[model samples]
Target: MKLESYVKLTFLSLSLFLLIACTSEEASKNKTEEPTKQSQTEKKKENQTSLKENIPNAPTNTDELIQYPGGKNAGKSIGILPEDEKKQVHKDLDEFPKITEDASETEKELYWNNLLYLFQEDYIDPQTVLEKWKMESFGSPDIEDPRFQFKENLNVEILLDASGSMNGKIGGKTKMELAKDSITEFSSSLPEGANVALRVYGHKGSGSDQDKQLSCESSEVVYAMENYEENNFEEALNKFNPSGWTPITLALNEAKEDMAEYNGDQNTNIIFLVSDGINTCGGDPVAVAKSLADSNIKPIVTVIGFDVDAKGQEQLRNVADASAGIYANVNDQKGLSEQFKSAQDIAEKWDRWKRDSLSDLDAIKVDRNFMILAFSNDWGRKRDKQNSNLISASDYLYYEKKMITKEMYNYLSDKRDEQKYLTDRSQEEVVSYLESINDKTYGEMKKSIEEKYKQK
Candidate 1:
């Protein structure tokens, strides 16, 4: 009976030992798992905090900040929309080509984010940009002498059209006689030492079909370009008789040759083309004028349409415009004198501008340069901010199981494009102005002459 009791006690001790081993193993498993669970919880909280910090606060009044007014969803948020639906909306908004087909969705998203910032509806005001531009200096120093001294070797050529049209009567006197008288008087009023030449066209043939070719080719420098001589000019005036086709092109070509001896920047050459009709010859006067203007002599070619019709005016005007010259219209001798006076005034104004306007032009150039720099720098800063804001907003929406609408992205993109266009245009305008300063001033001078002398 005692042996049986000892065996039962040993079995009870083995069972206690097995129970303790199982408890220790269970405690070790719990200890290992607790840290992993706590780590996961901490990571999730950190992600939430970061997302909240990244999201920009919604504007109190978007109407003033955003540019999309009266849109169907202008002020509405699309954060609650499904991702697929948002993508479809974006597809609908797509107009111009985006990056490329191979671009990943992340890249596309980044591009959109940039657009949102750059083209925000309410952006940096243009006036603000101007202010910033005004504050900077472009480093254009003043010149000791901006005045352009006039070159004294002045040569003037009078190209008179002696076609049959000039035989017409004005105030009971033949147009030719009146023109000759006017030329004589005008020459007497010119400044001393001025070289002058007389050219005549259409003085060799009758205005008939049989003589058309000869008349068209008839042009002569009756008085070669030289110092003004009253007797020689009078002889030249009386030599031509009006009775043929108007060979305006031939006349201009001959006049150009007459000035070959003194055609250069060291001298100022001017052509006064007096015509009563269009070029009857199959010649391109406009082309001739352009060539003359582009020549080394580069003489100023002013056209005086004497009692011409609409067609003649158009032709003459085109010649003047092409040559960067001026057109004047006159009916009688009195009008002719006034037109000549206007020419004198224009010359004076041109000289004045050359002497005094260089400083003004320099200032304008400096201002334009500063403005361009300001515009470019401002554009970059604004674009970066816009992109950053868009990225944060997009991330926030993604974390919240929301999405940005295609319309929003498209609007931003359009705005960004518009700003870019504006910046480009601003730069282009300044550059163009700088390049055309001299030409523009000359144009103004010509315009003034035309307006003052053109027939009412």
Candidate 2:
């Protein structure tokens, strides 16, 4: 019985040893799996990091594939181009065509990306060819200047002087008849969307206010585009004739009142004053001019003087000057008609009276526009001062003279806005100036300027 017990104990020990060996092998397998999974995770992390770093740098390699913004340098710096341009560049790059499977990867990629960037909205990289195009046809980037174009339609007021002189012959017809004929032509010549008015004076008489002063006036916005008739323009002109003395100031004032209610998108209000003379009946012409100079209802004063004497000349000049307009001196009655016709043609062809204004100082280059010292109204009063356009030393030794004024100082201010023709001088100043300057004609003042500039 003792021998049998010993053999059983030996078998028990062997079974325990085999079980421990199997457990050791299982642990080893688990240890090996942990390292293998760890290696895979590390590799994945490295790949993501590399991608993140490379995002800002475009690939130089031809074989490598990448996306770029359209209308831009994919591999280079982008500039000034807007969003759509960026996408276009990218699209063209994507569309670089492939000829065959064996084609070089660089060539194929280039072909595909180029076409893609050209057409696709989302494309980022653009090819070399697409970069050359520009948007100059769209005009200036400054849209403000272009938008100020006169509206398509216009409204015109032909304010004519039907004084006794209009009865005299011109252009094989009386000045009055010739003016009517031209007015008729202008009415007929206007575009489809034009509103025209005819205001005439001297239709009354020398003895009557309607004739010599203000009452003889008549007005009609005959072919108002709002109520257009092809022949209606001609019919309106049939009712004008010669009447009384030239009351220009009264006519203009009345015109402002007449046009008060007629508002439109385009502020095209014109006063075509055709007359033989200036203010003959009543009212102050210069004061009238001063009144209209800076007003919002500013009419473009185009004066045509028909056989106008010195008085006629002075009257027409004042009217034109005050309104910021052009004056034509026609010697003959026929010339008057032709001038009117020319004016009509000009009005028809150009939306604006002139391409740019004569007052546009820009047309006269600042460098050559003025001999500053001579133009000044103040000189040799308090001190003898001289100035060159550009300031420098030792020039005062030359002892030249210069005139200066408040207007001059304002003009030379560095920050003055260049877009406008004139400053916002007060109307009171203008009115006062007009009232005070009756004894001083431009010619007389100019003639005595040199003598007055010297200190007494």
Candidate 3:
């Protein structure tokens, strides 16, 4: 019985030892397999991250990939593909022939054309390539003394359209409201001695066939020709609301009469006609504008078509052309305000000119420097945008869509870098040219800069 018990104990110990050895072997196998699996996963993630690192702020989706941050398409998408078309595009890209250095010119052209076709939405127009380098004309620089001076008193008359369409909304505010605010700001900021007048048209009757005659004849000077008075000007603006048919002809005719006393010889007359539509009343505005231009008033009529339709713009442009003036079409409140700001700048320059009869050489130099800085900044922004867009597009094509081979993507990237280098050199050259002419006389500087950049 002792021998049998010892034998049973030995058998039990051997069985336990075998069980422990099997468990240890299983744990070791799991540990070895687990590291191999984890390594594969980490390697895959590292490869993806490295690919994405090619583009700064790399887009994860096609929508973000095609959106442009600047250029003429600002605030808008560069390209948007429908689902079916996108699938077809992916297939085409997958089968696209690779570009090679030893390829014939025609083959190379075809390959590049196909690639560029995919990104045609981001194509920059050659005509507008150097548009930011274009200089703005401040005043007549050819004169012996380039000063914004007027020998006579200045008269600024505003013919504001109170037609029903002025009630239209832009950016949550009525066109009339925006015009009133801008006009108020403009008049208040004018030179102290300048005479200002406010006239309202189509403010008397409702915009109905029954009241068309009254509306057509409704043109009156709400504020007489005098220096700006805040309370009086605000009261005059409050007296009118958007109403009645547009009687542009009658308004222009009445404006001639209003400024009949302020002839061009004694007063530098400037008439700003703000309208949203063409003349609804049957009258000849172009003829009237010509008459006003020919009269002793000799007013420079600047017709501002505030959100005017194409047809209305044409007629308004004709009126301005007849008067030997300018036409400005404003789409929003901001654009309208910018137009007014231009006039305000003129007023300020006029005041300065009156105070100082001679040219402000220091002011001219500062203005030139500011223009140069603006040009440089604009060029840099465009360059960076172009480079970022190209890199993002390449990454999207190569990794996300698997459309292009690695070699092709690398070639494209190298070409993009080269183009960026060229543009950088061009920007530096242009900025250097502008700096070189910083101290030149106004006429000489204007001529040199315009001649150089206009051709570009």
Candidate 4:
């Protein structure tokens, strides 16, 4: 009986040992597989974090907005892309990201910046902005006379008012002193072969009413109409002083007689009247000025009011208007000098007109070429800037932010290329039009270009 009991106990112990071994092996297998699963989960989270860190957040402040380098908006912040371009982009792209209410600020800004890749400004026509070429001429160059071809005799008459008011000071110099200096400088600078005359009015008597008749009849040609000679012209300017009443009417009448030989049909006459006041003596200067302008000597009367009163300026302006001329007011020496400089420019142009017509034509060609080059370069720079901005946005959206799929990014690139192609075609058309008329006569070119491009 004892032997049978021992056998039963040993069998039970073996069965229990087998059950404990199976449980321990199963637990160890599960522990080993769990670490592998945990490692995969950790790696996925790390990859996602790295992607978010790769791109910086979009700007929130206006100062951080991207700038444009060229175009009408140069030196300004980039604005929202136009609705037309946005619509076109939307048409080509599928599954475009939406800015939901819950979207982060960075995400919203990123979407807006990406659309700037398609931003384009309206094309500006060069003809609407560029100035037409103006050719300076003396009388008409097409005249048959040889004298008119190279030089149309130019007569410049300087009518000086030596009224008592001319003694007033401006910029530490008397009005008469400033006038003499500016007149001397202007006369010295005149083109050779041009005639100049200096006529002084109201220099013979005092401003007193008792001497009004003598002052009114005092207009005299100090320097007869003749080619400018430095020593002789200086003597002429020194012959007068500020001492009398104004006789503007008498001066205009005498100027007509002084330039009677030089008719408008053969010469260009210009009169520069320097005055400190209106005609104090009883006479209608505006009527006389009109008569002088209508005479054989068609003079272009330019009046300079030197510190004149409002009433005096109005009277002088009326005289100039009646004579189909201009009136300028000057209160200082510098202002006076600038007025004379304008006349000097006209004289220089006359000097240039005396040169060979071929040289003048060459100058016109050079000016036109410069204009064309400037326009072409401007167009090219705007195109390059536009393309550069588009590509830069595309790179940021696709490579850095991963905001756009590769296919969508490529489609944007194609749109940029298409835009560039269209601009290039337009630029080519403008250049061709300009070059087509390059060889045309100055008159023809001026007329055609002005007719085409004048402000609407």
Candidate 5:
């Protein structure tokens, strides 16, 4: 649950895209035969086109059938992790920041690997340093049981902004419509036994009577954390008839209380917060975020901004970062659907870290000896929240532990996505970004972590 280094590698993905798009070399090559897919630009353009069309492919329309009965049914996982993966494995948390004087050479490697791995840079080649670390590495969640791989279960909580603003179009479709479709896809991807929940705000129908009006502050518990029907998530989306302003802070607190009903650790809970405006029911979101952090619930709260102003996006950003989660600006259904795609590697690693940290026999004891790993999106604090739904979830998993199914394989990603926007390293941007940090010996960054993470 501690904050480590920022994984501040200068990602040149955008520059890389530009470089490929406007490659000086292209002019000399061919004014010729429709460039083949071999050309990166041609390929990327095609992919982007496909991505745009598929964005609305999820359950955006009310008439579309939700393929999965409930959120827990199986489907082909959408995102696939890259084959290369790098991890910092450690014996335990106590080994962080190795105090050299207190440890010998052999122990330092394990602790260093674990500390750095806690916040490993996605761009680094995990396979490159095998010899340096002299340890075997596991890239991602191995598909052991296709039907029931040993991934840590995530109790998903979806917080939808059913405000009028959401009714607006982003990427050519209503944001609310997009969210519901994406949720349907997201839920279908989960392993059958995974727990889930849904909380929709501003869903009360509007009417002249004050009591009848569904305000932005209105939050409905459409589902608790458990296996659900496909219609369950869609029904909530259908209610997003646009009647109010956003109440993000109130929504989170409501979710926190609802999640408290579960008996499991907060680590199992995941919150997807979708919004489109500044708090109409204004309250201090920062304070609420700090509360979640303090509770050790380590919930991964991903905030999606839809067709909103810069200020609205910033507010959501702060809440997400403070809560140990991710902030994504998704204007259309496609962007929203891909939120999981962007964080796929982290999700897989999270499951693996949990599996590796504790043997199946140990789920009962809540072993203090094992420390948890976290990603920028997978903040460590949200994992501490107590949940009531996980009791049956754990039992269901224990009893139905089947081999991973095709459905499960699609879910596990071993590493970061290959095309995820890392600027293709324009030397200028990389150098400039590196220099601004006072390029003061990175050795300091290295030294601080070693000393702090070292074990007794």
Candidate 6:
């Protein structure tokens, strides 16, 4: 089978399995009716909060349980084209004059409207213009294709600054504490298959000159790169305290070796180097960054200046530029959280776009099938009415001892044939237009993803 067919078949099977499971669960619950009814009665009473009638209810943790006001009315009220508008469209199509080469703008518009009316009859709306606008408004999220060689597991190494400055307060908490909170949330949100590691610098000694030597050499892989778990990560965060001088260069160099085993074009390696000050270890960080950038691991190093001074930011930016990475500056706890959130948001957005696009494609096909079914029903009704009229006329003629003329019978038969021909031709046109739009839609989606994320 073709790849597309295989994918669709797999989805259909999964959907069927879910449906059966739900049906079985419903049946099992129906067998225990008394307890279920009693629990539901009590639950409904407990849910009464006396909120304003006009206010929309808040969505629950599981969105499926939230009841929107108006129920079925909510769905019935919304449409791309209203029922009255659809009737007007049909009326206009029937009355509009045929087009000419020298037709006025109004006539030309009517001609186009008639075509649109026919297409809409099949529930197909050509939305290339709207799609283009959407592409312009939101651009596209970076999405890496799974078919590419870059299919190996993701590896992220966070080089956190544990220098003395991190002990400083931010929004009633130490900077270290804020970083921990943001990182925890970030880690929790990452997709399950990712491998994560934590490296901390300057957590061994005081910032005083006496402890400078120890601090400079304090960069360590406190947690090696491995599948992340909440408890282990929390424990790792608790083990470190901010006390020593900053040793950013050492951190960068260590990160290279930490990810050396996973080096390849197939795997993605990323580094988040967070610091609040310039390197004080008297080593060349820019040169170290350059080396890491040129390593086999090919890490994308993002240097984050966490509430740094102007000079510190400039130095950090230089290191980022040297490594061909991006530099971001965050000043407070909120900024820190947002920066971390953005990292996860990028991945989430790509997944969302793909899923939504697939749903839209399926909806288009479903609408097409529904349109065909409706058209067939309409044709069946006309056929049955024509046959009934013919039989009644023949019976009346027989009762009067007279026969219907052959010419009249042939004319009626021809009308039925013409109706069938018109229906089939219009159906063909609708299907052809839909196929073209579907092709364009898929192309646009592919371009959106490839243009943003496909690696050079």
Poorest 10 consecutive residues of model 3 by lDDT?
A: 68-77
Instruction: Write one digit per residue (lDDT tens) for candidate 3, span 1-456.
Output: 999999999999999999999999999999999998997666444333312122223222222222211221121112343445345445645555433333443433344434433332221221122211111233335333212225457788999999998987655578899999989988999879988999999997889999999999999999999999999999999898998999999999989999998867666677999998899998899999999878988776778888775467679978987886666666556657766665666666667667876445566567657767765675576567556655655676778776456766776777666656666676677678768876665557556755765421
TM-score of model 5 relative to the true fold?
Answer: 0.45
Task: Report lDDT (Cα) of residue 403, candidate 1.
Answer: 38
Model 2, 162-217: lDDT tens digits are: 66667765334576776776666566666555567767665555535444334434
Question: TM per model?
Answer: 0.46, 0.41, 0.54, 0.49, 0.45, 0.46
lDDT per residue for candidate 6 within 14-44, as digits (tens), equals 9999999999999888878878788665544
Q: Which of the numbered candidates is closest to the native, going by highest TM-score?
A: 3
User: Sorted on lDDT, highest at the top, how do the candidates line up?
Assistant: 3, 4, 6, 1, 5, 2
- Candidate 5: global Cα-lDDT? 0.45
lDDT of 4: 0.65
Off by over 4 Å in 6: 1-150, 346-456
RMSD (Cα, Å) of candidate 5?
Answer: 27.2
Off by over 4 Å in 1: 1-149, 343-456
Q: Where does candidate 5 have its weakest 10-residue lDDT segment?
A: 67-76
The TM-score ranking, best first, is 3, 4, 6, 1, 5, 2
lDDT of 2 at 223: 31
State residue 277's C-alpha deviation in candidate 3, in Å.
1.2
Q: Can you list the residue pairs that collide in candidate 3? A: none
Span of 10 residues, lowest total lDDT, candidate 6: 68-77
Write out the backbone clash pairs for model 6: none
Each prediction's whole-model lDDT (CA): 0.57, 0.43, 0.66, 0.65, 0.45, 0.58
List ranges where model 3 is wrong by over 4 Å.
Answer: 1-149, 361-456
